[model samples]
Target: MSHPPAPPTSPHPRRWLTSRARVGLVLAVPLLGLVNQFLGFFVLVLAIVLIWKDNPWEKAAKVVATIAATALLGAVVPDPQGKDAGGTVARADGKGTAHGRAVDAVTSASPSPSPTVKPGPRAADYRGLRLDRAREKAEAAGFGVGDHNASDDGKSIWMRSNWTVCFQKTGWTWSDTKTIDFGAVQTGAPCPEEDGGAVPWPKMPDLVWKTWKTARKEVVDLGVPADHVLADTAYVNDTLPDEGDYDDWRVCVTDPSADSDVTLDAWVTLGLTDPRNGCPKSDREDGDRPSLPDRDDDGDPDYHDPFPGDRNRDSAFPNGLPRGSDGSGGSSGDDDWDWNCPHTRWC
Candidate 1:
């Protein structure tokens, strides 16, 4: 009599894992170095399969035996003595090694610093739904409004004072990383090359122009009358080169003639730039290059008091121009300061 065919073999535990699970395991192999949770899960799953295939009650014995064997082996290993103990102790006491490894990992994984983005004529680069509306809001908030630049797309607006805002657009958002005060500006370096050689970033001139316009407008609107507004168009080797960083520009609202009827005296300096370039040229005559002046004409080095204490000279002097007038409203000396008395000149 032909014996009944042996029952078909049951699927192997390893083979029983789904193709998806197998793929998952393969992909997980690389992550084992950094992620311990997945590693432990993989090992657990493997152990379960092995235990299931063993003799029914054999799993319990296997686990107990493994524990007892480990303990016995550990005890037989002998208490390391002298030189052997010294090596083990050294490893345990190596605090510096642990710290160093942590630091190395952090340094290797850290992201590089990103370049700054400046406010400009772009409407899409700014905040608020309407460009003009946003400008109005900023002006109402004591901020000077200026021209804007939008990306090739009209979903954002870049304005003066290192301000950039995004318009409502799907999947678009922004966070104000920082606020810049225009009063404490320092001369900056010129914008650096973006991709290769010479000509500064193309976007710089726009920034410089926008910032100057804002500051100028604020001063005028605030009731300070300016006789002349001169903007540098030369790209000379300057002391305060444009840094092209997003810090705000230094804002100075002063009257050269020391004769205005305003109350506030505002002076602020801040960085402003795009990751690409430095300031924009206010006077478009130079064709995008910054015209660094030979002398500081902004009343910097010469006059001790560049501007009147208050917008109105009346409040500052009370009685028609106080006596000594060496230009600093103090006693006169032999300095050529008297020659330029009352006349503001750029350093």
Candidate 2:
């Protein structure tokens, strides 16, 4: 009829987009968009139009083409730091590649607020704790501890757990190299009012009327050695007493005399007596007397008694002589016992 209907011609461009070429372009559009969004944009549009007109592609191909066209419209720039990643990339997809990278750079360049630093603790925080405990806490807090007696007693620290911290010198916070110099005392003792070199020896206190146990505590607390203090009855009742028995008896006299200065190691004697028997009139009872005739029957004997014949009269002499007597065993004074006693001592 019509001259064999002339040779059928291809609907697509003969040189590049023939039937085989169109199929290849449709499949390649997604890859092209991934490489360069600008290039992908045109190819994606062309692929969609070819698919719709010639009906050469399946429904899946058409779907792919639409998605590629919308997605490749702009470029995407991912944030390297992750701080602005979601917002930056999402914004870039809507804008173009040049605009996307510009926004990404600004987002990454913004300076983060400088991080603040925290300081460490001070040594004074550990004051009043046991030396061992304080040292542990201080070391954990990045500090070192050095300790000595706050009473200034010249004693070496052999046991840290037995001592308590009184004061500290290091004041800085969180110092790795700082050593906290601590003034310390024994666990049971109170801290000194002020730092001292050596605890001053307390004077001998009058223990009269105080129990043996009470007397021991007073001197012992004042830095006296417990063994140096002793208790005895001087045969007042010929009754030997034990520690528990001491609680029953009361102290009547002290050896060094009350108010005398004594050291920590000084030996002290307590004269015990039954409260019912009452203390003897003897000025002393620790066997220091001469043991001569006690004419007045007072504790003093004639050998060195101030006045052997008359207890009421002051001996006329000081060098062991009685009132105008010859070879009297009295030592009250020897005509002139020595000026040290008559003028300067008890009248």
Q: After superposition, how far is residue 60 of candidate 2 from its true place, in Å?
A: 99
Per-candidate TM equals 0.17, 0.37
Tens-digit lDDT track for model 1 on 1-347? Answer: 89888988886675556533533443343344234544544544554444345434355765754454334334334342332222211222445552212111112233667896555322222342344455555555544444423222122333334432332221212453322112111112121232112322112111222455564555455333453333332233323335332223342222231232232232322232322234444447756434332233432212122343323122223333423444354545443333233433322
lDDT of 2 by residue, 1-347 (tens): 55656678765565334546666776676677777766776787887677667565678876776665455443342224645544333243444543433343334466777886543334456678999999888787767667887886677778999988877777444445666777887775666777754444467887887877888788777666788888887444235445676576777778888898675447888887655545555666665622334676645445444665665334334443333343433245445443334332354
TM-score of 1: 0.17
> Which candidate number maximizes TM-score?
2
Per-residue lDDT value at 154 in model 2: 76
The worst-scoring run of ten residues by lDDT in candidate 2 lies at 97-106
lDDT of each: 0.35, 0.63
Candidate 2: regions farther than 4 A off: 1-121, 171-176, 197-204, 209-231, 241-248, 255-269, 275-347
| Candidate with the greatest lDDT versus the true structure | 2
